[model samples]
Target: MTTPDAPRHSRPISFAIFLAIAGAVGWWAAFNLTVSKIEVLENPSVDLACDFSVLVQCGTNLTAWQGAVFGFPNPLLGMGGFVAPIAVGVGLLAGARFARWFWIAFNVGIVGAFAFVIWLISQSLYSLGTLCPWCMVVWVATIPLFWVVTTRNLVEGVLGSSLVGFGAALRSWVVPITIVSYAVVVLLAQLQLNALARL
Candidate 1:
């Protein structure tokens, strides 16, 4: 039931805060990765700060072909892409109301990022046989960012009205779902790379 007093897509302060925090964390990770990559380029002999060990380090992933999938360092993408969420969150907190089109575009971008993260996770665990700390930080932020934004859009009928109820149901389970998503990554890493023993 639509009412004048209550809009379908009301501002969510908590979601806004979440977005801000996640965006900041993601951006920080991307910045660190970019720095590491540049440092490697400047001096190949230098050991990176994030290189905790052979199995847990950023050097292997940074030098790999996967890190430059777009012919540029992947961290560049993160450095730029993460800014959008921060802006959107700050805008919402400032009482800005966005159009449905804006939300749709944002969601689409998030879906792309999510898909990319999944691919990176696969490449990291199965192919690279290593865990990059900065990359994992990006993953942690992206996972929940995707889930929360998508679910919020669904609840607000930005995706469609028909899915509102389903979105509402999912809203309460976002945290658990995020935890399970993280667990899946951990389990895969452990099974494939013996991440626990290596650490």
Candidate 2:
């Protein structure tokens, strides 16, 4: 996985740009959520801009126990966690080559983020019964980010040499795969929450 001999141009410029853009979007969503949380704290009954309706609002999710799974606002995690991808993307754009260990660790973080997003989706659709607008933006950013990074890592042999061929095969289908992933979420929301009518 170590690519000490790999040429500088081995880095994918498009992937770097995508990573930076996704990270920026996710960070923006997190920042908004953090501000909303602060406003709620300062005035418990304050209404947030993200609150659209009973079925489409951030108030419920923000106040729920799930929002603070780690005893703090969940958006705080995003505020800090998203910086990694931004830095990595900018580094790659600046001709910085990451070591194998770095890629492995970064991939692990992305996997964790994807998993957390899955959990939040479940909570939003089944338990919370509402769609947080800003949170959905975060989800949109994360879903594709996870897919692209994981696929790129596999294609680059960051995960393992044995999976390189499979990764290469999957790389070209990443966009479609991501679209299907989003479709599944939308379908679930429609089926369970009748989200389409509510919106």
Candidate 3:
């Protein structure tokens, strides 16, 4: 499951870099999805560019009951929320270290994001019977962002000074863990949707 080591000459891929990349990608996807949602809102019958296939389309999800869970397009939250990680990552790269309270707050937001994405995943897999590609991008970005930040906090002694072995393992096992997690999702999607056959 381990892929490869990061470039040696380059600075090691820190949690901050992961945060920045994930945030940027997630924000971009959310922005696109939001625009697609608007397009659908203007004309529900119109086809979206992201509507690639019946099972891999965003249009179905955009109109789903869970899509507007808070009475507005969910991407609005992503658009706003993703900026924080990018900012924090930039700050870190610029040599800014955050206080414990800030880390705590940031982690709380990440946990919320993780929970919300899980709900969307279940909804997409079980209820909607379709996929939102951009949303999937967000989900892919969000999961590792959550784990990387959390494990970094643990490894860096940001959260606590205990469980050194556990922290080390989490940090070392990132690639494999992500591979396994992604495999599980892919397997579940294939199982529930028979995703490839429908294509």
Among the numbered candidates, top lDDT falls to 1
lDDT, candidate 1, at 180: 100
Deviation (Å) of 199 in candidate 2? 1.0
- Pairs in steric clash, model 1: none
Q: Residue 78 deviation, candidate 2, in Å? A: 0.3
**Clashing pairs for predicted structure model 2, backbone only:** none
Q: In angstroms, what RMSD does candidate 3 have relative to the true structure?
A: 7.0
- Candidates 1 and 3: which is better by TM-score? 1
Clashing pairs in 3: none
Where does model 3 exceed 4 Å of error?
A: 1-13
Model 1 segments more than 4 A misplaced: 1-10
Candidate 2: C-alpha lDDT: 0.92
Error of 2 at 165 (Å): 0.6
List model 3 lDDT by residue over 1-199, tens digit each: 4448754233334756877988999999999999999999899889899998889999988888798899998999999999989999887777677788898789889989999999999899999988789999999988888888888778767778895557788888887888887888888899999987887
lDDT of candidates 1 onward, in order? 0.96, 0.92, 0.86
Writing each residue's lDDT as its tens digit, candidate 1 over 101-159 gives 99999999999999999999999999999999999999999999999999999999999
Worst 10 residues of 2 by lDDT: 2-11
TM-score of each: 0.95, 0.95, 0.90
